[model samples]
Target: MIIKIAEIEEEVVFSGIICADRFKSDYENVDFFGPVEYSLKIGRSDKRLSVKGHVQCSLNLLCARCLESFRYEIDSDIDLQLLPREMAPTDIDLELERDELDVRYYDQDEIDLTELIEEEVILNIPMRAICKEDCKGLCEKCGGNKNLNECKCESGRDTRMAQLLRSYLEEEGDGHGGSQEKAIKVKKG
Candidate 1:
């Protein structure tokens, strides 16, 4: 969607493209349908190419533990000062950088909106997807989903330090009063 600065006054949906987004795995259906809402503003110097807007989309993702799919929303704000590719100013203060391409550039009279909108959607995907806040997930011992039904596997959740200390006491048998001091030291440590 190219928003020309000279010919825009009201807020309008100039460009809306629903792409496959295969480069990023946000949607599994090969094509995640969405839109990008943008508008143009004439700058102080009467520049012909300045645009700002927001992007939003939603899709389903499968949880790793439970193997169930759920909904995920992709929403982000975008504010970019569009500039002609040849007129883009070179950043003189970029550390460890030379005369290299910095960001997405546009032609003399038009702008490409696909790249920026896709970037926002790709960055919004979470690292881990869960069905619910209190998802029980699968049983550790047996391969079974704990959300739907209970498992016969023994409880292996041994995160208690006190229980481990008691087991160590059973092994040491309080020899010469050294174990008690060691236990206190361990606790303090």
Candidate 2:
């Protein structure tokens, strides 16, 4: 939905649900259960626009580690300032002030609420989706979901440090005929 700047007298309030299918093309991996819901109050002060609202949705996602399907909830607060696209800096390397972090740009006469809603939903998605905090994930050897069932494969220990220590012990033994046990005790002390 596009909000025309000319139509706003002072402020406009909108609340509605956006269908999940609307985002299917861009986010194929994520399955939206409930439609995206929003409640926004967009106020205009001359040419400047301030948007304050809330956006929420339920997303069906696969856990990154175990690959199990899980439902994730997204609840985000929207507080942004919108300015004309012309106000955006032409220099790519230009630094932005702290207050400008929440600023967005709209084209000539309109603001695309649909695009803004999509961006909010996308931003709420977690970088790493985990079903649980202590999820064991998949077993490497058996290729089984460790959260569901424990595998019988031997626990693999990282041996790089052990290998380096062994090499060091061999070098010391060659130089001074020192016992491996004595060298280990000296190194520990």
Candidate 3:
């Protein structure tokens, strides 16, 4: 996965497929389902290097809402500029130019493609993943998946509200006969 800068004369285009198993150790949170196929263009001018590429892969992600595992496909483009550490700006207070956002410094004569691919994949992942819109999550009362089954629990009332409601009903019925039983039936209904 290491790309040697010395191998490239001026510019070179390389294409390859990295197996899903190769990234398992590096990206433990992601479950890669397919190979990452990529095409990279590497260009070197004096001490500066530029890398541009396209990567494609499939992943298994868990939905944040329903907690179900689902497949997601990713096709992303990457562009980076590499400068020698010595060539980087020395001023700490200087504002970074717009073009410098994507710039990176390399201390060695090689680039690690594995780390690059891992970064790309991780960045493309959604901040909050859902299996589908309007996904019904698990029922809080019985721990039943609301998307798959219906539960008889009172799904709306909070525990604190229900307790306060019960106490209020008991107090209201203390001055009246048989009103507590009627109020209980009404609440259930």
Candidate 4:
């Protein structure tokens, strides 16, 4: 939804649902399970705008570890200072001050809230989604889901460390090391 700057004289409260079609193309991989619900209070002072409210939605996403489909919920608070794009400095490597962290740039006399709502949902999604805290993940050998059942795959311990330890023990022969001599003898015999 696009809100025109001219429409807001002082402050306006808007509560509505944004359909999924508005941002379906924005994220190809994301599948929104429902429409985005928003309750925003937009205030205008000169050309500057302040949008404060909350947005929430549910999404169907794949778990990073188990690769299973899971429902991810997003409930984000919106407290943004909207400024005209022309007001932004042209410096490419400029660092933003502490107060400018929540500032967002807008183009023309309208604010495209569709983009803002989509951004809030995307930012809340976890980088690595886990279905549960104790998810066993998939087995390496037979490619089976370990959460369902245990696999009969043999234990595959790396032998390089064992070989290195054996050589180190052989070099320390009979020199204040009884355990090392026993280990060397066990390996050699």
Listed per candidate, the RMSD to the true structure in angstroms reads 14.7, 14.7, 15.6, 15.5
Misplaced by over 4 Å in model 1 are: 2-49, 87-89, 92-104, 156-189
lDDT tens per residue, model 4, 13-117: 888898877666766456778798998898999888889999987766665556776776767788988888888766654526514668888888898877787
lDDT of 2 at 101: 68
Error of 1 at 101 (Å): 16
Q: After superposition, how far is residue 73 of candidate 2 from its true place, in Å?
A: 0.7
Q: Provide the TM-score for each candidate, comma-separated.
A: 0.55, 0.76, 0.70, 0.71
lDDT for 184 (candidate 3): 17
Shift in Å, residue 168, candidate 2: 25
Predicted candidate 3 versus true structure: per-residue lDDT over 1-189, tens digit per residue:
787777778998878888878667755346877688888888999778888998878777666556777776777787988877777776664327614568877777778877787777666666455555455666667877778876878645558887588557544534433322221111100
Which prediction has more favorable TM-score, 3 or 4? 4
lDDT of 2 by residue, 1-189 (tens): 988998987899989999989787776468888799999999999888999998988877777668888887777789998988888776655426624568888897799998898898877766556566556677768889988887777345637886577556544533431221121111100
What is the number of backbone collisions in each predicted candidate, taken in the order shown?
0, 0, 0, 0
Candidate 1 residue pairs in clash (backbone atoms < 3 Å): none
- Candidate with maximal TM-score: 2
Q: Write the per-residue lDDT of candidate 1 for residues 1-189, one digit (tens) a residue.
A: 444544544333544445444443544522244443333233423443334556666556666557666655555555555455665556665421323322345665655456556665565554454556455677667878988998867456445885577547544542443322221111100
* Most accurate candidate by lDDT: 2
lDDT of 3: 0.69
